[model samples]
Target chain A: MRNHNVTIGIFIVSGLALFTLVLFTIGNEHKAFSPHVDLHTEFANISGLTKGSDVQVAGFDAGEIADIEVPKSPSGRFRLVLRIDQRLNPLVRTDSLVTVDSEGIVGDKFVQIHGGSANAREAAASTTLPSKEPLSLADLLESSNDLINGANGTMKGVQGKLDGTLDAATKTINNANDLIVGIKQGKGTVGMLLRDQTTATEIQQAVANGEQATVSVKQASASLKHASGQADALVSDFASRGLGGKVDQTLLSARGAAGNLDSISGQLHQTMTEALGEDGRGVDAGGNIQQSLSNLTETTGNMAADTEALKHEFFFKGFFKHRGYYSLADLDPTTYRNDRVFTNPDNGRAWLEAARLFEQTSNGQERLTTEGKLQIEEAIAELGDGALNGPLVIEGYSSQSDSGTQLAASHSRALLVLHYIHARYQVDLRNIGAVALRNTPPPGVHKETWDGVCIMALKASS
Target chain B: MIGIFDFVGAVGLFGLRVIGSVFRIPFELEQIWRHIGEAGVRSLALVLSAGLALGVVMTLHTRGALVMFGATAMIPKLQSLGFFVEIGPLVAALLVAGRVGAGNGAVLADMRATEQIDAIEALSMDSFKFLVVPRVVACVIALPLLTVFMDFCGILGGYLSEYTLSHISLHLYLTRAFQGMQWSNFVPPTLKALVFGFIIGTISCFFGYTTNEGAEGVGRAATSSVVVSSLLIILADVILVKIIFLTFPGSAT
Candidate 1:
């Protein structure tokens, strides 16, 4: 029984030994008992990296860290050693970058590798690849400190600028407000200009006063103009009537007494001898007296006869010369004055009336005079209707220059001459408005030096 | 000094018996078959239990180590590499050495103390065939099957480990196991286990059949078998790894 037990024990032990072997052998092909490769990476600061952490390429997990071996150098810096799978070695390129990151905000630290340029070579095994230094706590604190300092300085400057600007702005606003109040209170020039009401009252009073003065001026001007017209007509009419009646009587009487004036001159010579008969020498003295008396009386008689002859020739000879010879040429003044019709070579009728008036009234015609005014009106009307497009002359004369002083005689004469024509006679310039504005420059010469006359030529504006 | 001699004498006697047992094994195979049935079938529960337990324990324990490295998905690799090269041979050899080696030694001690082997020798039938050969042959055959069974159990253990400790499902584990890697990874370990089985069985038989110092001698033989077998297993693993790693590292890879 013991021997049998021994054999049983041996078989059991052998089977058990085989069992143990099976476990290991099965694990072997599966790499459970196989050796694994170890690779490492290092960084200046791991940023809370721990062992057995994942290593990723791009986003995929290519391997893990088997161990973290920190080899201390003489300088007391630890060179980190990480064991990684050999399979993942090729994923690490020459320029691949690694960053320390966490799964989430609080997850474990991992090394994330960024794929490098396509042309780069893969990192080899057992190689210590370069690593980027992660931002340390000191760096963060330093940057934050700089930011705070900058912010503080900016705030200080802003505060100071704001203080100065606010004070100046407030003062300026107060001054503006004071100026506005002053204007409301009617102070200074602009304040009064903007707010004063007394100016309006004064202006209304001045307007009423001006109206009264205008009414008086209107009455005075009307009275003066009426008096001037009637007086001028009466004076001119009487002069014309008296001169005509008296001159006619004298001409008729002289024509009738021509023989008697011849007989009286012989009687006056015989009378001179009778007054000398009182003395024997009376005959010689009387003869001398009579001869002297007779010579004086005879000279006076001859002058009277010559004056009558000149009058007859002037009136009758001009009438006869123009009546007998009418041609389109320049004629003598007396003849031209007698005829109002002068013909030009262009077959146009030139009014001899204009020439006659120019000669007759060369001393400036008093258009306001009342003689033959109807005739003047008819001539003006005819001239207008003809639309001759010819120049008409309007003139003015200033009886006074300066303050009755010849000191500025020439200057005032020119100026006053233009002023009178503009103010009085130059009215109705639509028909005839020309002025030969003149100054008494030389002793015998009155030259119209200024001809600044505006001519209104009518045309349609369309 | 005595201890050294005793060990020397023990190894010497063990060698002689092993040679003698080999010559006698074929004739007594029928009787050995009976022993095999008795020892193997009777100890099936224990063998399977111990084998499976060792396999599972080793797989789970080592798989856990691999897991911390995020290598849990490689549980089958763990199982294969471990079972084939180191796990299958060494574990099986040690267990058999401890169990069968002690059993044989005790049996020989009993025969010696009771004069059973002496009596058999006097009958002119080879006592080596009757006592040593049957036991040796029994162990040699049984240990290998046990190792194979253990290999299976180890794979199962790896699957269970991945299931419990990892997110891997049993189906996936088996799918990965049955992948060509299983048969391929199996060839080396099981082959090695055959050698381990022979080594352990022959050593146990040698130590047991050569018992000399009576009851004490049997105890000594049992202890020696275990020690020698364990040592041989280790030595064999080292040499095998060198040859494999050095010559065909690619294969292991």
Candidate 2:
């Protein structure tokens, strides 16, 4: 062979000699090679511990594990063995905890000690490390399950509310649908509008016309508002003159016109009656009625037949008569129209009211005291007036009575308010008697607790 | 079996016969030193390569089991445990035992077959004193030294795989590897290596020195020496473990 013989003598001797050398060299790593102490501990579970493990102080390696023994379950406690290097004894405290941990995943297990305390004293050699209970996987899963359950409960609550709301909304929508269906089948007023074709057509046409009329009404209202403003301005202008003077002037002119018209119309009427009233009053009495009508028309050609329209229109009847202070007798004595024309058919009176009121203050001809007379006269002399209310009391109570005596005095001091109808600004007195009544209960009701019924007895009006 | 016992007793007696041959060491050392060029130093590469490769295989085998739970990260620790605690020492010890056991047995057996041992006996010199003790002591000493060398190279091999495959920084790997170790991890192996070398050397030398006639005896001696040494190594390991680990397992680190 090219190679020298491979001797077992060379092989075996070389292998052993060098191994012994390195053993004592790396021995410096542990405190045992020098002078050191040892500590021990036991626990219920060692979990897969092996030798050569570390004792950690606050996650830092402080010592090596020195020994392990599975002692006979000492005093009923599970057997465990530990040996901690003594040089690191300063790091262990009485309150320190010891636990077993795997060096790596699925690796050999070792005992890890978490040591230290601010107030705890230094632990002695052979000190037992306290055991700690760690949170288990089961605990984690339970809490996670609880959170999921809570989330599920929240979703269920929201689902229930949504379901109720949807049901109510669906029911409401169904009712609305039924209403629409009823209308299509022609029930009630709404159904009539939808189902009656003639009524619908007429209403449609009316609505069109009404829409047009609405425009005219709006324009009229606008014009009337402007004219009313102008009227107000004119009235304001005339206020200094007092409307009584104009009313007096109008009454005089109407009297003069009536006088002139009465004499001429009377004469004409007599002549017509003697000429045609008797002889041509009937068809047989007349000589050729057509010839007479023609002759009548020829003679009256200078006259207007339109004068008859004046009677129907009340052109001869002044609107002021019913509302006027003067009666027909107060007209100028020499002037008159037909006497019956000024009469009111409803009252069969020639005037709205005929009365005399006289007041005297310290005068023998007086029938009333001035204040009483003024009050009554104001109430009575108003044109077209009637009583609004019989009378009401205005009682004033003094503050002194609250402390002194009876539960307040009731008395009457004045009449109630008079109301009127504004018929186109003509204030016609209308019968009315309504008053807003308020009765204040006495003050100072003491505080009361619930669970009791409190009754109040009402007093009839005295 | 009785004859076998007598034969073993005769061999033990022959090996002790050479204890007085201490004066022959200088020449023997010279020869050993000369052969060191070939056996130990020359074959150092093969030894180192085989040791390193064995370390890698050991590291991977242990790590693969641990990695089911993703403990490959702890391979340096495991490799350290295997090498320093068991594999590193055992592999190197067995290698030396095989390599030295067969060689010693063959040489002695060949010398007997070639009539060289008889010639030494005729020369009025104690053949056992001249030949057996030097080789036995040499093997006892040399095998452990070789094992130590193998251990160092195996550690390096473990580190290479760690650095190459797992990317453990040298600083971190060295630190963790050294962390779980104690004097016991190293001392027990080296001491055991010494015992192992003695067993291998004495048995193989004994087998060959008293070997039956012919080349067949030489072959049988060499083969039997390897087998016997291997079995003795396992038995010594078991006893040593009880002494080291069982006696003081926790503090052994």
Candidate 3:
């Protein structure tokens, strides 16, 4: 009976002790015995946060949610009554932000109170802290879906433009390619120049004649200056001597010298113009030498274009792609606007209005302002971290009345922005290009015309 | 079917008489204590071992599924919750029903077969109060305490299994295990074992004390005790769980 009593006493005591341990451990986790203060917050969406969910202050477990008051209407927020440990009351402040957070990607939701700034006062009990509405997974997915759909539409448009551009580029390359083949067979003017020794000889003679004419014109100009000086001395001497007949003889000789000098200068001018063409006029008014040289220049230009096309062609592109042999320097406005490099769907662009970006100096020259530089910096930031990795183009636009003024203003704006970016960011000059669009915005840029500069960060095709 | 009803009626009448005798004067405190020692202390090792083994198996089973969800940290919590909320009480009752239920039936049936119960009646002592009330009262008092022991042992067993795999600290495991628990969750399920103990003690004692067939009936009484008590405990558990849920709605969490 004594042994039985001892064993039963031990068993019952141990069982009760274990039960008490469980109760206290659970109570400790919940801060049930700790002194606590109630704080309030309201959220438009609780995001499935239940009453008794864990409440954390700056990621430290504090207490559990005491209660949740449902709103009277859909627009009204759900008021949450949070019970926080009094020891952590100092961390809770009037300016502290409250948000709904979770344990992991798909875990239980909890209330998180971000500590307020040190300058703020400690929050009083039952004070309603500002709450940020939680971002639900459904809302996130919906926004992303809309973004993806917009991106898809933009990509489709870019694809259509790219196809058209590629087709045109292909036709241009083929024609140039045909011309190259013709030249190799000795069919074009360039071929004739290469094959006909007589034409080459004549070009050499014309160049020699031009050189001689230039020398003769220099000699004639020196003689006219000398003759004028002599005439001035003779008139002075005649005035001093009062010799009328001597003045008449000297004047006649000066006239004859002036006539000869004029004749020589005229002949030189005519000969130079006939060989090299007029100052602004092209090969049409020029002699055969000028026309032949023009044809030679055109042929070389076609060859250069063909070589560039070959570098991008499927067969040879692999060689140049990774070697960094690709150049954006020679990109013209037409090609740039059509090329996938600038028009790729992944490219980022920021448009700053001209009025905001530029200020006119006293000399009537427009320059980038301090605010304009800040705006540019913000625009670059908006393009994101990868903005500097690829080719960047500054597209200048102007709404000036005349085409000449528009072109000048647009080009000036683009050049100013380009210089600022290069100096401020130290971006590689080779990786950046500038174009004066002269009032026309790029296709599908959401505007028909814009008086602004568009900074385009063109990502390389994947 | 009529025989089943008759047996149920007899059990109900026997239970009411035991309840009425429980509040009467000259209570069997010594006998209740002795029976508590037999039913609870003697059965402690079996309940604990079974609880520990079940805990190990439950952890191993749930660990794989929880790991796939990247929720392996929930293993300790799941273990404790499972044992406390349902498994500990149910398993403890069934084990007691198997052990003490058979013993109670066989001992009393032997006494009845040999006319010891008749000898007690002849001496002017109430045979039901002397032989049956103490055993039923002991069961009602001891089962819940045994369940508490079972729950803790199960949690410790889970920790052992978890520690081997993760080398988790005991503090962190215990913290996580009890982090989501509440008084309502623990108290209601544990108290429900009282009903289980009553079913086991009453059914077994009824079989033993009411046996009329002499020596041949002892084996039959013992078998019926184990079988009927086990079945009634299971049925009572289902209803008791629902009642607990209704009474304490927060425990559902």
Error of 3 at A95 (Å): 2.2
lDDT string for model 2 (A341-368, tens) is 2211221111111012223336432232
Give the best candidate by TM-score: 3
Candidate 1 off by > 4 Å = A1-462, B1-26, B54-70, B165-167, B178-184, B243-250
User: TM-scores of the models, in the given order?
Assistant: 0.35, 0.48, 0.59
lDDT, residue A44, candidate 2: 53
Docking class for model 2 is acceptable
TM-score of chain B, candidate 1?
Answer: 0.79
Clashing pairs in 3: none
TM-score of chain B of each: 0.79, 0.84, 0.98
Best of the two (1, 2) by DockQ = 2
lDDT of 1 at A385: 40
Candidate 3 residue A430 C-alpha distance from true site, Å: 48
lDDT of 3 at A136: 87
Q: For every candidate, what share of the true interface contacts is present?
A: 0.10, 0.61, 0.57
TM-score head-to-head 1 vs 2, winner:
2
| lDDT leaderboard ranking | 3, 2, 1
